[model samples]
Target: MDSGIGSQPLQEETADLKAPIAEPSINLDNRIPGLDDPYEHALKPNGDPWAILLKPEMETDKIQCDAWKEEVQTLLIFAGLFSAVVTAFVIESYKFLQPDPNDAIVRLLTQIANGSNATSSPASTSFTATAPSLRINIFWFISLILSLATVLVGTIALQWLREHQAYPACSPKQTLALLRMRSESLEAWHIPQVFAALPLLLQSALVLFLAGLIDFTLPLGPKISIPIACIIGLILVFLACTTILPSFQPLFLLSGRFSRDSVPSPCAFKSPQSQL
Candidate 1:
């Protein structure tokens, strides 16, 4: 009887407390009311996702994206210059791949003179490739090709970045929503990752060129080639050290990345914010 009385008070307390209401679920498919007809931004050809952005986040992301774009431009510039330099080397190196007619004639003459007294026939005047020449030419050609490819990819990436900056919005109030959509789209499509890879391609081209240069100098005697080889070796070691330093110390890679101005937090995130 005592237990039943205690349980009756607990049941009464439970009945007095009202059930908690559920939070409304987000509905992305529904068109936002009072906005212009271009509400379905995600489905359009130049689609931007419907964005819910905090103003501060939008501003900060803009700064980071802008900095990243500038970096790509700089990379393109360097790639162009490097490609020209590689082309110059390529022009010189490619000639060695083919047999020189003058050299064939010289060999013929030397053979005829040496066989003047012998009754045996002279050797055939066919060209043969030397190991060092073949290796150097192959290395340099690949390097030149890689550098040119970098320039080409850089150009395409820059164009994509340019096209992405514009937001598709019919009304001025929808500006913030559109901006956030475009920013999200950029990240979703992996544009930043593309920018990151450009440097790696350029670096590969540089390494190949250095290897080819080493092969080219090695043919000369120890007196001349030794000094050149040592200097190049030192350069390779320095580049390797600098490249690896970033893995050990990440701050070195991220230094000076931020812009001088602070990113202003204009407002908090809202679906279709009034002002962009």
Candidate 2:
């Protein structure tokens, strides 16, 4: 019986050792729910999600977008000059159409009221009536319309250039290659340089038109009116040469054989030639 009791104790010990110990119950509920994966909180301390997720390609895209913004701004400035010239043309046209006759009438009345012997001459009236020619008016109107059309074309071209600057499907490398090709062709032909200069030419034409209109309509004698018109013309020319021309100097220099080799690739994201 003692031997049987000792064997029963040994059997109980063996059975306990053979049984699987329940892994300390995991109790996922106590895990604070979403914190189960340690890597889920991998964001930097500043917590800027974009900064953390940004890639090389995204950085390149941002640089390209910035460069496009600058080019658009410069082109807009050039286009604005066209609008300014158009405004000046309209003002001069209005002045020519509705000249002030009150000054002459007032002078005549003042002489009559003062009982002066001076008589109003037919020559002065004839000159006033014949000053502005119908042909000149028609020419000025047509030129104004053309100037406006030029401005419209420039704006449209700028928009098109912006669209062509980048494409979503294009790999950055391919996009850069295309940008270089375009720059090379444009530089070789120097087309943009010529286009940029058109504003100055149009401004000169508009100024000359205004001077002629003023010369015809002004009540003052030719000695005074001619000099005034000349001064005004000079001022307009000065402004165009000093302000607009210098602003576009860089664009003008962006072409030619020297530029083809020396000019940096148009794409801001492209590696430098030396690096390449």
User: What tens digits encode model 2's per-residue C-alpha lDDT throughout 130-154?
Assistant: 3355445665666566566555655
lDDT of each model, Cα atoms only?
A: 0.71, 0.57
Q: For candidate 1, lDDT tens digit of each residue in 1-276? A: 999989998998797786676889787767556645555335556434434234566578778768767877887888888888888888887778777868756766776786663444445566777888889888888888888887888889878866766566454347676666877887899877777777777877888888888788876778777887898889878666665544444353348554558652322322111111
What TM-score do all the candidates reach, one by one? 0.62, 0.40
In candidate 1, residue 236 scores what lDDT? 79
Supply the global lDDT for candidate 2: 0.57
Residue 48 lDDT in candidate 1: 41
lDDT of 2 at 165: 58
The residue ranges of model 1 lying beyond 4 angstroms of the native Cα positions read 1-58, 107-124, 246-276
Stretch of 10 with least lDDT, candidate 2: 267-276
